[model samples]
Target: MKPRLAPYLFVTPAMTLLLAFGVLPILVALLVSLTDMNLGGLADYSRVSFVGADNYRELFGDAAFWQALGNTGVFAVLGVPAVIVVSLVIALLLDRGDSRLFRALRAFYFVPAITGIVAVSLVWGYLYNTQFGLFNHLLSLVGVAPVQWLGDPVLVKFSVALVAVWRGTGLNVIIFLAALQGIPREYREAAAIDGASELRTTVSIVVPLLRFAIFFVAITTIIAWLQFFDEPFVLTKGGPLGASTSISLFLYQKGFSASQFGYASAGTVVLFAIIAVVTLVQLRARRIDAED
Candidate 1:
């Protein structure tokens, strides 16, 4: 076989799938965003009208859109850092544990990540229950009032963010654990010889070495939180007056509940832009830090 032909043959299947599933849907969505398409249009091709930027323009004035956007921003900002820091800390502890027991514990920490979101939500929902929940039960033992977990708007934001933290930290734990294990022991030993304390060694050696893994986890966490849906949708359904409503859930409401496909598609494009800008900003910051 010719060298060039073999290379193409190896990539042909993956490239074909990438274009078919990834690029194709994006192109179709972009086209749909320009038109005023809905359920009526689904039945008749002629019903879909080219509204141009009307849907996008309308979004700027939509109160729900802005609220949902704010909720999503809060989740991403708060949850992403919490996940990264907690996971890294746990990974560091587990890395030091280095025994059969710790190995088993590592597997235990990962259970939440593998569990279905609905199952996690149901369990947490019951825990957050006012009458029979374990959390309030514990608070009662401490002589504290049963604070509304999902009822009050302030509590609802934190209530859902807590569940997100629980579900998300597991995967990052695994990633950071692996990265921790991969770091050369000689680097730490050299640091020790140079009179570096444990904290100094961690700050100077371990963290810099784990930069790539940290960056990867940070980016993925931000993207995931920006699209956070299942937790808020299942737990509160973006409820108690849209307190925990996220961009993804709002998009779901627009596309499926209201059958406003074009409007939802326009929201999708805006969301895409938001994610792109945020990711780019992080990349720029990372680059600047690297330069410094």
Candidate 2:
């Protein structure tokens, strides 16, 4: 092969895979969203009539869809910041401590991230059980009434969000800890010499330096929270009047349960557009931060 074409040849395999698995599926889904293509319609191509923007219109007018979107927004809005702060605190603590026991404790905290979501959900479900759960048992000790966790529509979103935060926070903690460890000790020492307190140094120096890692965690957490499915599906199944239903779970139910492939495709496309826009915004923010 010519030297000029060697670089292209090296990248050809990855490009081919991207087109086949990524680009092609997105294009197909876009086309499918323009038609009435259910399972039956897939079997009989003649029934797959073009519907233009009808599917998108139907999704827009869907109350359940809107509810799911709202729930997802609540999940992201509440869960993202909570997770980021909690993870950063843990990371900072782990970075400061220098004992073997602390290192072991850090590993214990990260165990949940490696655990399967379904397994964690199942465990959490038992813990959230109204009658015999650990949480209610603890509440009983405080003389507080046992709240219906998954049963109440108002509490269901919060319940699921808590479970998601618990399960997902560990990974963010690990990410932030790695970033904290990467910061030089000299900066902290210099700040201390200048009469800066630990809190002030952390706020003014450590945080600003970790902006890239923070931005990365925020963007990834947003994307992951948008696609939240396993916790809600396993725990509530979007139950208690659909309070915990997420956009991804809604897509799954519509596509598989209702067999509305085209409508699901439209939802998926919308989700893709939302994620793409958010990612671009994060990238621009990162660029501006770097320039500063």
Candidate 3:
């Protein structure tokens, strides 16, 4: 083979695997979405009629779907920024300190990130228990009434978002810490000499320098929040009148529970489009900032 052909040959296996596993499934799902396919229809070829965009239309008109989308949007809007800020602050503290205790603390903070979501959610579920939770116990000590953390519809989404932030912040902290450490010492010293206080230097110098990392963390967190599932699924099961039902959970219910494969495929496609658009927007914004 020629040199160019050799490179293609080397990548052929991986490309073939991707096509077989990824591309083929997506194409099949798209086709299925255009049809009135169901589990029964799979066995009977004549029953699987092409329904065009009827599945898409039904998904768009679904009140449950709209509610789920709104809930997901709210979760992402609140959770993503909260996680980024908390993580950045933790990262800054960890990056600045030299004590062995601080190093140990970093590991402690990161423990949650590595823990399985199911296990963590189970632990949090106990902590959010209406009568016996640690949270209620703490509130009792302060003469405050116990609040329903996950039971009430209004508070359910916020509670899930809080758990998501707690679970997610650790990884972003590590990422931000690594980014912070990569900054040269001279920049801080120079800023100090110019009468810049720690806060001012952090906001003006450090943050600007860490923009790329911040942008990266923000985009990832947004994507993660958009697919918010495990916490709500385990803790509340999208409960309290489906107020915490995320788009992912909705898709799961449609695809698995209700067996509406065609509608589920349409929802999945919409989700992919939304994520793609949002990610592209973030990338463009980052590019603009870089140019400025």
Candidate 4:
């Protein structure tokens, strides 16, 4: 192969997989959304019929769909900031030392990220239990009444978001740590020579250098939160009146539970549009920042 074409040849497998799995599925879902396909349609092709924009119209008017979208928005709003801040802070603290203890702590913090969602959900389920849970027990010691972590509609959003944040921060912490380590020690030394306080040095010197890493983490975190499902599915099952139902969970319930595949596909297309628009905006903003 010519040198000019070698890179494309090397990437052919990945591009093929992306087209087959990623691009094809979106196209398929878009087509499906335009139909009135259901379980019966799956069994009998003749039963399926194109419904045009009817499903989209109904979806826009759905209270449950709106609620799920709102829940997902709240999840992303709460999770993205908390995840970025907590992980960055932990990474900063961990990076301050190169001791074996610090290294061990880095791995320790990452445990949640690699852990199976089912296991995390099971443990947190016990913790969120109203009566005999550890959180309620802790509150009792402080003369507080038992709090229903996952029961109250208003509280359930925060409770579920908190679990997601905790689970999410682990990987981000590792990312930030790697970025921090890549920063030159000379920058900090120069800041010190300039009589800069530790906080000032970190704010002025360290953080600006990690902007790219922060932006990367932010993008991934936003996408993950938009597709929020695992915790709610395994822990709450979008329970207590669907308070914790994310868009993904809503789609799951509609597609699998109610066998409304066409409706679910419409929702999926809407979600894809939302994510694409948000990400493109972020990329544009980042490009603007880079230019300046």
TM-score of each: 0.95, 0.94, 0.93, 0.98
Model 4: colliding residue pairs: none
Local distance difference test values of all predictions, in order: 0.93, 0.92, 0.90, 0.95
Evaluate model 1: give its lDDT.
Answer: 0.93
lDDT of 2 at 128: 93
Question: lDDT of candidate 3 vs native?
Answer: 0.90
TM-score winner:
4
Better of 2 and 3 by TM-score: 2
Q: Which ranges of candidate 4 are over 4 A from the true structure?
A: none
Off by over 4 Å in 2: 1-4
Q: Write the per-residue lDDT of candidate 3 for residues 69-118, one digit (tens) a residue.
A: 99999999889889999999999988878799889989989999999988
For model 2, residues 1-292, the per-residue Cα lDDT tens digits are 8999999999999999999999999999899999989999978999999999999999999999999999999989878988889888888888888799889978988998889877998899999999999999999999989989999998888889898888888899889988988999999999999999999999999999999889989999999998989889999999988899999999999999999999999999999999899899989988997898
Clashing pairs in 3: none
Q: For model 1, how does the per-residue alpha-carbon lDDT over 1-292 read when each residue is reduced to its tens digit? A: 9887998999999999999998898888889999999999999989999999999999888999999999998888789889999999888888887789999989988999999988898899899999889999999998999988999997899899999999999999999988998999999999999999988999889989999899999999999999999898999999889999999999999999999999999999899889899999999989998898
- Model 3 alpha-carbon miss at residue 234, Å: 0.7
